[model samples]
Target: MKYQDSLEQASEKAAQVKVFLQRAGLAAHPVNYAVCYDYISGHHAALCTAIEHKLSAKTPFDDFIMADLYSRYLTPANPQQEQLLQDASGIVSRLTGYTDLAAEQVADYLQQLDFSLLQLQQQQQNGENILSAVEQLRQQTQEFRSGQYQLQQQLEQANQQSHQLRHELEQLKLQRQLDPLTGLYNRSAMQHQLELWFTEQPGRRVAAIAIDLDHFSRFNQDYGSAIGDVILSKVARKISSYVQSSGLPVRAGGEEFLILLPDVDLRSASEIAEQVRRGVEKLRFVSARSKKALPKVTISLGVSLYQHSENWYQFLARTTDVLTLAKQRGRNQVASETMLALPA
Candidate 1:
């Protein structure tokens, strides 16, 4: 349904999609087919860009990865969430109107009370009229105080509702931004963190370390996906352990992960990358069913500095290219921008 290609265009793209699926050893299932079709058609800029990076790096695509891509980019928003969002917007608007109206009413009441006070001062010699005016003034003041107290109570209630709404929204946002398997940040969260860092301090240096588990697809094939998932989760935790609170650790689909370090230089990032690589290499896993030791898991990492001139995707792409270089030189190694400048 997402595709709107003409018959001829669809045919051409389908052919290309076939070739891509064949190359990746992925079956032409609906999810995989749609993802490849989207890529070939050049629609869905984000999906295209992601596929391009993977292709450039010769990363293997599997059923899980294909499904992930579709879910992340092509899947429709939850209807319930959409309805909730609309309701929240309406509530906020009404709250704003109520607050504005309360403020105006209070101001008008204060102005009337001031006029009454002035009249009382000027009519002081008219004792009976002054007394009557005083009584009127006292009643008006009491009404104003009571109204003010009521509005304050309403405002407090509104604030509480607003707080609760925000908390719920924050929880929802956190869920959306996290990878379900690894419990790490997802690409959307990563992009947002990058944007926030730049927005807060323009031209601030951000170091990116792109990491990929070497031969992870083969591992999944050998050990089965369930085991692969466990490995992924553990490795994610190990990677996250090294990143400070200032950094963001992300699961960038499949076996790929990215660490973003704001205000960090290339040297420090590379060191962190090396530490992550070594830590993953040191990890040992055993099959739950067989009690046999599994193959050692290792990671290849690429470190790069973000350039102010380029978008986050471009910066990530360059870092991914460096990761490809690490893969080329040998897996379980580190590559950097300096290496990017050198010959392959």
Candidate 2:
């Protein structure tokens, strides 16, 4: 009878251990079977001791074994089995001084974990958005730099073209103002200069000297107009050279010249006119038709100074009057209104 009772008790313990292992999600196979068997044996010993104490009307041994189990593993239980053991401890400690509820604490702890997970998700999303914005900004900056570089290159090219065009325009202007035959100031250029000078303030002295080649029509008749043109060119060259070495000269008309002297009195202009007259009297040119030496070329000069009351047209007329007087007098001498008015 004793052996049969022991077998029955071992079978009951094995069945309870199997149920516990199933609930705990532990294997009850050959690998963990020894541990399960040992636990069941200990539980059976405690239960037998409790039954004996109950029969004797004494302190229950089952309570003592339960207190020991709680002390060993319930207070700070295994992390994987904490929820299961905590639930069981609430039921068992109901008859004891254990009013602290583990279920509510577990619920609160799970709520905190959920809130933390939400915050982590939001932070990750914000980081991704910031990275996208930075990439867009980098692309825009690169495009702006490319546009700026192209604009700078275009501006430099435009500036270079503008400079070259301005230089060409200046050269063209110089060519227009120069006489091709004698390299002197042309009639249009001299008129422009005269207009510019006359527009200034009053009492600024200005003199005009008119020069005519002596008997130029007869000379052109003797030789052809071609040789006459050569003589005229040589005469222009000589007059231009003399004026550049002395004063300013302009090719005012055919075989007629004008000199403008700024800041000069009538007496000084007359002296310069006389100098040009003597200079031309010394010049000689060869005739193109006969290939023979020609006589010396002579010029008649007329000089007049601007008055405060005179306009540009009137001043030019007075110089023409003086040239007519010089031509009527001899045709190879310098004459001025002031010189002609003096007593002989």
Candidate 3:
């Protein structure tokens, strides 16, 4: 009865989400639905407020509202923001090296000036020829100018190289978190975010939505790896977009994606998982070469909330177990830890 109620709730929200989009004069699109569903399910309080404000003002809604909502609700700060800050600061500190070199050069110039003054005094005291002294001074002045120019050129070259190296390093750090195939955050990125959520914010609630593509191997076998690759890319792209800012979307393994929702409970997490499932279900795939439609693809999701006492590994294991149970019960259904804990 509880399972049936959740499905009924999902069905109702899905309908309301579509109606909200239509009434707002927004196109019924994936990105639009992601925001509306989130709002309808109360996953995004701020979004709900924004929509209410527009309605209260009696202003006509436009695409700009969607864009604004997306930026605010769906666009999460980069999980690697702290690391990026450190990397950027490190790059900027390279300029300090140049400053130190410049200081040394200034000291050398001062020392040269003092030595020249001493030489001039000695030349005068020794009654040396004024013309010869003048010639020697001219030679020293030319050498000083040439050396200064050379030092300036070297500093400029060093600065350019430092910038290039910093850019390359930043790119490498971003790549470390990204899956090469699906363009989603890889396992390492998810672990990084989870560590931050786990250790930094001890009391905060965290939930995991574990997802796995159904009969993924069947598609690979029937259409070849190329089509399978396309399917994976499309699905990952859809999942990644929905979790853009609100959560961390990770390509946990082949045909499996995990979304980490910070400060969320099991109910909200399951709703988001269901939204993802429905979005993927509506996708239509057709082959280019043969001009034939491909088999419909679906996914199973398991949601589990973090227990204050259990570590993240245990939390993830429970979620994965829930996912296993979901498959056993029926593929393409959303199951939660609560469901798993129920008496059989």
Candidate 4:
């Protein structure tokens, strides 16, 4: 799909997500939308899978789940932010110290002024000169101004430090949303997108395709962990390319993936899943040390279209179950809910 088309699709998905949340009586906060959006977008495999499980079992969509999702995907680096806030807090403490010092100085000067006033009264009663009393009062006034000047200087320094730290904190939060390993968005970013999609366009259709590698454990056993990793990277690249710009590719876990295609139908989505299966089967990974071709790899996929009456969790769980069925009936096949259904 064209870049513009891709952008439009995301917008539509976010709107649909919002509607889904509203219908289900879930909170529609950005954090909630973010978690749902990421799941719907297929950015956070584990998160989407968890949500799917909840829906499949007709579990309650409670606040605890939402809070967990919010912290994981939407606000993963709060501790870092908290650390910066702590630094700001230190500045506040220092500012308070400066304030206290100024207060003490002011209080001392007031006492001195009171003494000066008493001295002037004595001078008047005894008919003596009052010049010393006036001089003392002037000195106290100058001392107070000097104290204020020092406090203002400290305040400016504190403000500058707080401002710089806030800017750095923002940058860290933005970078946290992207997964460094896969280059796709992390769970948090996907969650953000999901919320945005449903909040704006809740009626659009969504489809999920779950893919899991067959015999992945055998590869790890035969060639060591390093070789297994190579296979995973290659397979992930293939799946990502097959889905391309039109869909979201997620590395759900070891040897498992999910592709989310919004506004897509079962037939078309199944074809895409089948294509990925074939492409993976064709991949040839060579052992660097032995200079020999390694064992062949295959995948099983399950596809399911969204049903409005069903919760997001349920919709994904149904898709995952279908994928599991593909593995059971011999691996390396594409299966879906429609394919496993009984005739009317």
User: Residue 211 in model 4: shift from native, Å?
Assistant: 0.7
lDDT of 4 by residue, 1-344 (tens): 21233777888877888886876667676567777777677767788888888789768664335645656555555687778778878978988898889789888888888888999999999999888879878988898888889889988888898788778877776666544455444545544555565667787677788888898878799899888877777788888887757567876545667788877888989999989999999998889999999878999999999887875656666777788789888889999787677432
Q: Ten-residue segment with the worst summed lDDT in candidate 4?
A: 178-187
- Scored by lDDT, the top model is 1
The alpha-carbon lDDT assigned to residue 86 of candidate 4 equals: 88
Best model number under TM-score: 1
lDDT of 3 by residue, 84-166 (tens): 57766765676676677677767876776777777778888998855765666677678767767876886787677677767
Q: Candidates' lDDT values, in order?
A: 0.86, 0.65, 0.79, 0.76
Candidate 3, run of 10 with poorest lDDT:
59-68
The digit string of per-residue lDDT tens for model 2 on 144-181 reads 56655665565566556556655655665665566666
Tens-place lDDT digits, model 1, residues 1-344: 35777888778878898888998877776778888888887879999898888788876676545766887888888776786698689778878877897888788888988898889888975554687788888888888788878878877887887787788788788888899999999877886788898899998999999999999999999889999999999999999999999999999877889999999999999989999999999999999899999999999999999998877767887888899899999889999989977988
Ranking by TM-score, best first?
A: 1, 3, 2, 4
TM-score (all chains, Cα) for each model: 0.69, 0.58, 0.66, 0.55
Off by over 4 Å in 2: 1-129, 244-247, 287-290, 339-344
Provide the global lDDT of candidate 4 against the true structure.
0.76
Sort the predicted structures by lDDT, highest score first.
Answer: 1, 3, 4, 2
Q: After superposition, how far is residue 335 of candidate 2 from its true place, in Å?
A: 0.6
RMSD of each: 6.2, 58.4, 19.1, 14.6
In candidate 3, stretches whose alpha carbon ends up further than 4 angstroms from where it belongs are 1-111, 122-135
**Model 2 TM-score relative to the real fold:** 0.58
